[model samples]
Target: MKNIFILAFLSVAIFSCGPGSKTIGDTSSSEIATNDTIKIANEALEYEVIIVEPGFDSWLISQPPRGYYGQTKLESKNRQFVAEYNTRVLNPTKYSRNLYTEQINYDAAVDYGYEVNYLLYNYFMYFQEKYNEKFIGGRN
Candidate 1:
């Protein structure tokens, strides 16, 4: 009886700790890449692409609050391109502004890689139309 119990416990423990057993805070590289691609593509399509981090917020937060923030990743010929975008409140002092950021990733070999900039542009346009009175701006 003792031997059987030990064997059963060991078997359970081994099987429970298999390859698919992910920790609580485990973030995969694939997920990160995908997110990066989406962000880059979205930003590229909507607003001008600024490689600098500080510039990211500036572009999004304009004088009168025109656009929002976004980001994405792109895989081209085994290379990766991370895209980002943001909306700026043209006149932050005068009006309240909301800031947002997003991103996506795709396989380098795949022709249909994700475009974060385009997605961001569409998202910003949608929100701009939805909330015409409210202006948004911030750094990300």
Candidate 2:
């Protein structure tokens, strides 16, 4: 009788303390730390991309490579540049939302002509300031 009771009690206790059990005071600091790390990494990536945009534009402009024969290659390249620039600027993420689609489109329109110099200049300045503020800790 006693043996039977002890066996039953032990089985119940073991089953109740199985892997899926969580005590009342259980809290996960590792999960919080992981989330923080992800946030920082994503921010760093954004800053890097923004900082690179002006240099990319300048490289594209200075290439002077031939485009498709017979067609207006400059216009086509400018369009591609605008699309890539917009996509880079509007990188999807949890923290930053893209609210400047129209601005990019407008800038693309202006870039189709020879007016992109000013826009590119401003973008470079903005990117530099933002990059320094976010990643470089305002050092540069």
Candidate 3:
């Protein structure tokens, strides 16, 4: 039983070393996974990246969900987002690629990628403040 107790104690100690309950890849709080690639929510057309670009994430977080913006605004914004995002994926050598997968998969980030919204949002804010730069494009 001593082994079990040691394991439990070590687990708690390891987990407690961070800011708090916030763990890597965990967006329930403010922690963000630096190694994040890309995650498509439900494997469908709606998705959000953890932290890849600055300008893009900034623009994305500014708006609301499907019903949040008017049809015209939503379409215009979505188009802009898609265009900028595509530019990033098209250039894999860039560092923004760190924000998501290496392939040109825009579908996963659309509509904030569903469940990853909260996590992405937190990452965005933290990234922007910490980096002192935008997170929109790879070159930028």
TM-score of each: 0.24, 0.24, 0.32
Candidate 1 lDDT, 27-116, residue by residue in tens = 576654443332333343343332323223334444233222222221221132222222233445544544333333333333433343
Q: Where is model 2 more than 4 Å wrong at Cα?
A: 1-71, 92-103, 106-140
Between candidates 1 and 3, the one scoring higher on TM-score is: 3
Q: Which predicted model would earn the best lDDT? A: 3
Question: What is the overall TM-score of model 3 with all chains considered together?
Answer: 0.32
Estimate, for each residue in 44-138, the C-alpha lDDT of model 2 and write its tens digit.
32321122232344444443333312234434544554555556556645223443232244333332333333333334334445444222221
For candidate 2, give the lDDT of residue 27: 41
Cα distance off (Å), candidate 1, residue 136: 28
lDDT of 2 at 123: 46
Better of 2 and 3 by TM-score: 3
User: Residue 97's C-alpha lDDT in candidate 2?
Assistant: 46
User: What's each prediction's clash count?
Assistant: 57, 0, 15
